[model samples]
Target: MTEVSRTRPTEIGLPGPTPRDMLRSMRFISREPLAFLGRMAAEHGDTVAFPIPGPPVLLVNDPADVQRVLRTGGRSWSKQTVQYAAFARVTGPGLLAADGPTWLAHRRVAAPAFHHERIEALGGLVGEAVDDAVAARLRTPAFASGDVADLAELCHHVGLDVVGRTLFSVDLTGQAAELLRTTGSAAELVVRQGRSLVSTLAWAPTPTNLRLLAARRRLARATAGLVAQRRDAVGPGAASYGDDLLGLLLDSDLTDEQVGDELVTMVIAGHETVASALSWTLMLLAEHPAAQDRLRAEVAAAGEVSFLRHREALPFTRAVVDEALRLFPPAWVVSRRAREDDHLAGRDVPAGTLAIISPWLVQRRAEDWPDPEAFDPGRFADGATQRPAYLPFGAGPRLCIGRELALAEMVVVLARLLGEFRVSLPPGYVRPAPETLAAVQPEGGMPLVVTRA
Candidate 1:
């Protein structure tokens, strides 16, 4: 590690390693971003400057500094970086990739659909999807015949189905397989762009670009078809098709392209990240049987629990989810580009600097979390006070809009699965390395053995 000043002084020059440090940092970040960020914070301090080829790049690990950049200094930063530019190809100007007034407009139109009450009302939809997966996939002979099933893939399918039903009131179980393949391909393309400085060349007529274009077209057609169907169904003299998100967008003044962008954004961002979170939660539970047993007991006590109605009663189960998010946040890294010069934690930062915040690193700081690596759900028990340090879903105006939905889905799935079956890693199983494709996910998939509890 290159030696640099570790102290934080008001208005001090940015401190980071030399140019050589940038090359090593890039290599490690490409392979293991969570580890790389954690190591940087540990060796340096909460804020570490890195000498990239272009403008200054700072890795911020302190919660206070993170809040300043994401919450207070939000106006000075924008998502117009290479990271979100890649997402815009697929998501367009939707809430995920949009910034400034466009983002605010989109958020206003879509926020009502994700209200706490509205999301709770969609709990039944989530439960239905999980039940279908349990019956048709998890409990089937193929999964029960001593052959391990990839739980990550299973969750992804169920997540996509849930989002389709809840967002558009359409059942996508039949199209789940194809949608998963297309979305995965598109996601890999975006991840590549995020890692490459030549990301602007993504529009080139290369084979990869062609494949990405084709994938985007397919997804657009599917979403556009749903929007048209809903519009036609609500024409004059037609009965209302209920107020799903599609119905809301159709009733709004958003153009077809804008509507399509939001649809694709919801489909990709809504499901994939939740699936990864659930997968990692399950993996953590398998690794720590005590926590798993406690969760199972909590679920059993609340028989036929409704996530919305009885979530307060299932404290242990909720804590397990919270702890899992802390350890392995699906959206592990959040990046922003400074639109103007700013000060973070009293350190002077120049304009056009890249600010990187890793929830994986901040949550694991020894100062905030005792025995940070231990899988202890009790840390989030009732009256526990670590809110400022916890940011699994991010913070500020740009915080994830689907946070409530994701939490509900995870809680419902975990309760149902752990209540019905015992999940464990297969013998000789090795934890897969984490990959930052779209979201932080296991490189291959999480394969676990399941049997009746």
Candidate 2:
């Protein structure tokens, strides 16, 4: 066997980075998540082991291995305790981090909001938000831009608006900017705390905890206020949106705290991912004019870019969104732990071991994707490649309950933007990778130059 083949399962594995290098990697994750992960993948092949954590934590980059751990053999794995603990503190048993019966319950409750038919119905709302966002950008004279519109922020606002209007019957557009700041800060704080084994010891009298508590209070207040308003408006029929997520959740016997948790989790998880996907779609389109032309033609042929209409007309737009997601998956890494002793992709995983399945790596693995780095949406169209390798929304029973909603939202937003705006990267702009908290967002936000198409 080759040296790499023989040493693949070693505990320390490869020449691991030193303490300084480790710190640098951590900082890079905080500043440039996607790039740091890509660097790690390059240095170590499909499965790389890190020295931290009680046992060696394996970063699985191969798609087949990813599927084995996340779906095909999920029974052997569970969400990392670290994540569940941190997320539970804020969400109180919400779906994003919950496991077992609790997660299953939350999934059932929130599933309706994301049903394909229901999500399709919400297309008009998505189209309207995207159109308004694009129009806001268009107000800036073409080429007269100095920070015209932050696509990241715009998409965040669009997502918040969609969730509010469709789910809670609220107008969150006004609060979008504030919510963005508050949630982003809270998520970063949570991640910092979760990363350390000694975090709980330091939680007392620490500024991070103090800030985290304050942020949680603010988020809780906002969520409670919205829930109260929705409850009063609906009257006893709390969980009753024909297909709204909140209504289905209300149908369950979960406490108000649980409701608050789920609402905030959805607010944070749902929109940001789709927004990132949309932002990357724009970035990819600007980088490849040919793909953009094909998208524009496909969208133009569709009827009006209206959400309610043109369901069957925009395959290229959907393809572009899917491709962008595959390249820069917003939820880049999924953290899980082995619930029982399990062997995955030829490695023995003891119980309580952390397993990181990253679509960011798997989707672009040299072995899985041909011309892996190329910006080609057509690869996803019909039968050009294996579909299992793509897990942007995750896989298995725990797959994102909001996947359908997210995709519909992306397609509608991209179609509208392509139809109305000539989107491109601002001149001299360098596309930054991302700093992931809850989702991967451009570090300083995506500043793009816009013009009426």
Candidate 3:
């Protein structure tokens, strides 16, 4: 009997996918990953290998296999050098890219800020932000020739405003331009410099590496400024918003510097994912007006007072967001490393192997979904799915802490936007689907027509 160990092959049973073929597939997958993965799974079966160098890459398509790898089999995996190598450029040791007890500890400390009860309390802030965004949207040329604006960008502003009020008690409306520039530049640096091992080398400092360092410094400065303002706001006998993320962290064991890193991490996590989700939802709604119509009717029935206040009453709006997340999850791919030799979907996995389980592929599998490409929010009616697949916030114990908050934010924005305005994608929009190291975002921007309903 052969005993599997660390030195043994980490993954097996993936018929025969060469490292080169896997790399070539990666290029095409980068463009249309969902379709590409569907083709690969069909051609190569359940388990397929991608050519990522260092170790063999395993692409798990089965939901059961995905569950095994993420939960029961997670101990055999790690966040590893690959994911951290890039994200560490900005977040440092924050939970997103950290591994082991450190990540767990940070998650524990940060958990209070996003708990369901705490999130429900933030509805007031979310509502205020939505109101501001709506005002700005109405100011657009909807009265004249009906100019199209970027719904995703509008959502980003909304997310930023929400994060600002709820996290730091600072309104980001005035600082949004600078904030956007800093985050956008940081993302570009990660994409360019964080991809290769040579760039991440600490011993040799290159121009790219220097740029990454500078980006982090700028981000820290901005974060620190916000923190200082909040810390000063702690007055005598004043009721503090200690439950908000920033307030919670301010009371945590993390130092101001550490707090800054985590704050930036939260800002990006709190904004980008929700913003992309909102953008994708609008895009899908534009493509499927019937779903939008149903949502509008539901919101109207729920009451036109305000969407964020009536979150509990708008089931159809929630369904629309859920379906959008299924079809186009912002965090579409889950990547991890095997710490020990393991078997996935009857395939033997060697230690140190990188595994990618994609919701983008799983949610729309023909076996799991009927007419998978079609936009149908009715499929997710009543907060249920036809299959065990569809994990927009991820799965297992490591599921996203901000899941409820993101959902609430999305529902509020969707209900409000659809309640007051009719949406349509601009002619020949042809925007490329999102490509990023973290959340998905359309390549250029998402432009949509907004007319008073």
lDDT of each: 0.81, 0.71, 0.74
- Residues 1-453, candidate 1, lDDT per residue (tens digit)? 333334342224655566556564576667666676777677667888776667777888878888877885348888877888888888888888899988888888888788877877887889889999888877765666446778898899888988998888989888888888888889988887776543468657988778878889999998888878777767765454457777677667789889999999988998899899999999998888888898898888887765565548787888888888988888877788888888885766788888888888888889989999888888888725348788888888888888878887899999887888888889998987888888888889999888688
What TM-score does model 2 achieve against the real structure?
Answer: 0.88
Question: What does candidate 1 score on TM?
Answer: 0.93
Off by over 4 Å in 3: 1-11, 20-38, 51-54, 72-74, 140-145, 191-207, 235-241, 304-312, 385-387, 429-431
Clashing residue pairs in candidate 2 (N, C-alpha, C atoms within 3 angstroms): 239-247
- Whichever of 2 and 3 has more lDDT, that candidate is 3
Q: Write the per-residue lDDT of candidate 3 for residues 1-453, one digit (tens) a residue.
A: 111111122235455355545455555554556566666676666677654556667778888888777774337777775546678778888877777887787888888877766666777788889889878766555544356777878888898888898777788888887787777777766755433322357545888677778878888888999888877778555465367778877777789987888888887788888888888889888887887888888888877434334445877788888888988888767677789888777657788777777788888788888998887877867667435677788777677788877887888888777878888878886745666546778767788887778
- Scanning candidate 1 in windows of ten residues, the lowest lDDT window is 2-11
Worst 10 residues of 3 by lDDT: 1-10
Candidate 2 lDDT, tens digit per residue, 1-453?
011211233564333344445654565555554565666677666676765747657777776677777784347888756755776666667888888777877777777676667665677777677776666655545534334467777787788788886676567877787787788888787777665432274358689878888888888999988777767777874446334666666667888888899998977787778777877778788778788888888877766654433435676777777788888888877778888887765767777777776688788877767998888777877623337788888887778877767777878777777776666777787986566666766778877766567
Cα lDDT over the full model 1:
0.81
